[model samples]
Target: MDEQQCWEIIEAARDDAGQAWDHLDERLEHTLTRHLVKLSPPEVARFAEFFRALQHRVNREDLFMAAFLIHHGCDDDGFGDFRAGLVGLGRDWYTRALQDPDVLAEHPAVRARADISALMLAGFRYAPERALEELTGEEYDGYYDSGEPVRLDDPPPQAAPVPRRLEKLAALFPRQQAYLRELYPQLTE
Candidate 1:
């Protein structure tokens, strides 16, 4: 499926959950899987491709730094989960975040410091694969040919320069830094 179609599926899942951030991991996975199961296997596979591609789009150091500050120090796995959770926020929020990671400071979940990891929306990261498995009675291996590397555990080689210190990250994302301070009043620049 194309990017727009991919977003529609996620948006539908968000709507299915009444746009509430609570228990979104289970809710989004169920809704997204329900939508994917109705499609042909190839469509499901294509959706997986697009999903990974979109995740890849946000695999940058700036976003990683934003996640680190928001989540209180992000590792590789945390960054991956954070990216998936960002996608789960829907297209408009995702695009705005792409333009300015600082905008995340205004997000309700971020303001509440909710865990934006596998427990949030990353369970649906593999929803298309799960749907394919259910439909074809076999595990999905369609992601191998998406032309993107499968090393979600590894930072991308072309990732932008990550600030080496919290002070630098704070300087780069002043708005987010302010929000972070609000979350952790003891934190200092």
Candidate 2:
């Protein structure tokens, strides 16, 4: 690990207070962007918006946010933080719709989702929902079409579900409970 990562892990793994200060400078996400590839101009702006929305739900401390980001984005592809990009785009949609509920109220399909959580594990795969063949309705028409295949994987891929993703991450790292208790007293209860 690099100097910054080690220091960050040490500090970030501390109590919530430490994490807040450490991350306050955006250091919490420095390593986050380090591994991130880049996305299109639009995708980058979109994900920034999504990450902003998730900032509110960042309770339960780092694990929740980490898990969410890792689960959603954290892909080492050229466009880093793939999930963040999509969710950001989705958040923009949500905010726009909130200001004008009737815009999508007439649309049956777009009515039933929040946070772009539903967008993961799909062909859109957070590339650009509006650009994707499946999800976009009126939005797809006359957009700059980038027919790039976002993956180097086999033609058909099956990604894990959200719950399974959480379990999987916990299992892989398997941080000790006692350590967690030391870091977060509330975890013991």
lDDT leader: 1
List model 1 lDDT by residue over 95-163, tens digit each: 777766667777777666565442235677778778888888886554425454433332333433433
- Model 2 lDDT tens row, 11-129: 33222223222122233233333322233434433433333333222222323323333233222331223233232234444333233322332222223323233223222223233
TM-score between candidate 2 and the true structure: 0.22
TM-score of 1: 0.74
lDDT for each of the candidates? 0.70, 0.30
Worst 10 residues of 1 by lDDT: 150-159
Q: Which stretches of candidate 2 lie over 4 Å from their true place?
A: 1-47, 62-175
Query: Backbone clash tally for model 2?
Result: 4
Error of 2 at 174 (Å): 5.2
| Candidate 2 local lDDT, residue 42 | 45
Count backbone clashes in candidate 1: 0
